[model samples]
Target: MNSLSPDSKEKTQKRVWEYPVPIVKGDNPEQVDAYLTGTIDEPSYYNELCHVLGTAEEGHSVTLHINTPGGIVDTALMVAEAIENSKASVTANIYGTVASAGTVIALACDDLVTSRHVSFMIHNYSGGMQGKGHEMKARQKYTDAHLSSVFNYYYGGFLTEEEMERVIEGSDIWIGAEEVAKRWQDKLKKAEGSDNG
Candidate 1:
């Protein structure tokens, strides 16, 4: 009887294990259910990200490629937390643009790599409220406080306390790849050193 060839065995082994790529590319323009404009707000997005991180293959890094203009703060935070808690190394690649909450998610990665033209924006989170005048003001205040806490929680890790304060004070803070690289080099370097140690 003829024995199974090496190539046949390799193909069989390859079929046994399937590695998943969980990057979410927003729906295309021609797609019927497409909502490509603005930020992504699908709850499934957060769930999928968590699942990918949780099921990542051992000894391999997970690269989250992002190009988003930012979206719901809570969802972004959830995704960021999933990335932060992942056992595998998480690297974020800023392909085109990452603004607002997107920037926060990028910072949660163990390593951030960006292309030359990549840009990110940092700004306070804002949401609309529908209520009576008095209730509206109270709601707004509550929202502002929550946003502030998020800013402090996320930026505190990547930026100096003073730097974070400055960014928070701005109406909108935009940083290019070069500026981001310069500002976070020290933190990234330290992380690398600690990982090696």
Candidate 2:
């Protein structure tokens, strides 16, 4: 469950830096800092985040600095679900390449910010197992259905169904910062305007 099929093997993270990032609110208030680097292979990542989110005060925020190439889809989804259910706000800063399940996890945040050179990618969730011919075929169908469910959950309004299909059916897509800004700014601006009005 922690690894994907060989077709989607990502290079191991050569390095990871974990540090506290303080965000000031109301003159001065402490905030939680969490980093999601490399792969999401273990359940601990999700558990620790759930603990942090649960302990943080309401209206307080936790910043999740995401710099991963993605990992176990189910594990990432667990963290994503925790974020969705948490009372504290979550901001996911995509600082590097956020791909596959990583992208889905990022979308669970209340706010998303992309670094100048960050790239985002969304494609099919791929997993495979060894079995007899019929078993393999059934597994493929199950994987496909599960992937579609994930896609819909994370990107229901991001693009048209047809466009989503094209990307899922085609090769991996690299979405640069400009495209992210274009797609996300309108929603942000709309919210800002409403707040001001």
Candidate 3:
């Protein structure tokens, strides 16, 4: 029960990693999916995302489709904060590579929807320091606190306390949707069980 030419062969069988939610197309009068592609480290990028948030009406579901290689860390944090404070229930739909600060901004959404093919990365905060030994040490301490906060922002949803510390100290941890999905599963189960009980 196979359909293949005598000389043809399949290199690899395709597999589905995550279930796709069918976003209703055609005439969608009730919701809007705002597109946000390219790098997130630019001032213009942050302005645009905020513009969208500002223009949105209350109770509207705004989903941000992010496809970027990420940009500036501070910019990403600003965007994330905007999403977190938005009146609209924000959903981040990441279908492409969202690394660096992009991952930070995306995770700020109330709901995160990662495509099966998406890949993400998280690294500790990095910046230059030029001062005396003690001054540099103080800067390092501040950087450490900032790095820990960002790491928690991305992974705090489900990671245990011990695991969180380990991950926060990591240099550059590359991951995919599986990590997010696993965490989301735990949260969903807890919510459902609590509701039933």
Give the top-scoring candidate (lDDT).
2
In model 3, state the lDDT of residue 105: 73
lDDT for each residue of candidate 3 in 1-197, tens digit (9 for 90 to 100): 88766445332212111112112212554366655566665565457557666666678777878877776787877777778777788888887687777777776777788789887765655558799999999988887887787777566655556666666677566667877666656755655687799
> Per-residue lDDT for 195 in model 2?
77
| Poorly placed runs, candidate 3 (over 4 Å) | 1-32, 131-134, 160-163, 187-197
lDDT-superior candidate, 1 or 3 = 1
Total clashes for model 3: 1
Using TM-score as the measure, which candidate wins?
Answer: 2
Better of 1 and 2 by lDDT: 2
- In model 3, which residue pairs have backbone atoms overlapping below 3 Å? 41-72
Estimate candidate 1's alpha-carbon lDDT, on a 0 to 1 scale: 0.69
Q: For residues 81-172, could you state the per-residue lDDT of candidate 2 as single tens digits?
A: 88888888999889879888888888888889989999998777666589799999998888888878878767766545786888679657
Instruction: Report the Cα lDDT for residue 97, model 1.
Output: 76
Task: Evaluate candidate 2 by giving its C-alpha RMSD to the native, one decimal.
Answer: 10.7
For candidate 1, report its TM-score: 0.70
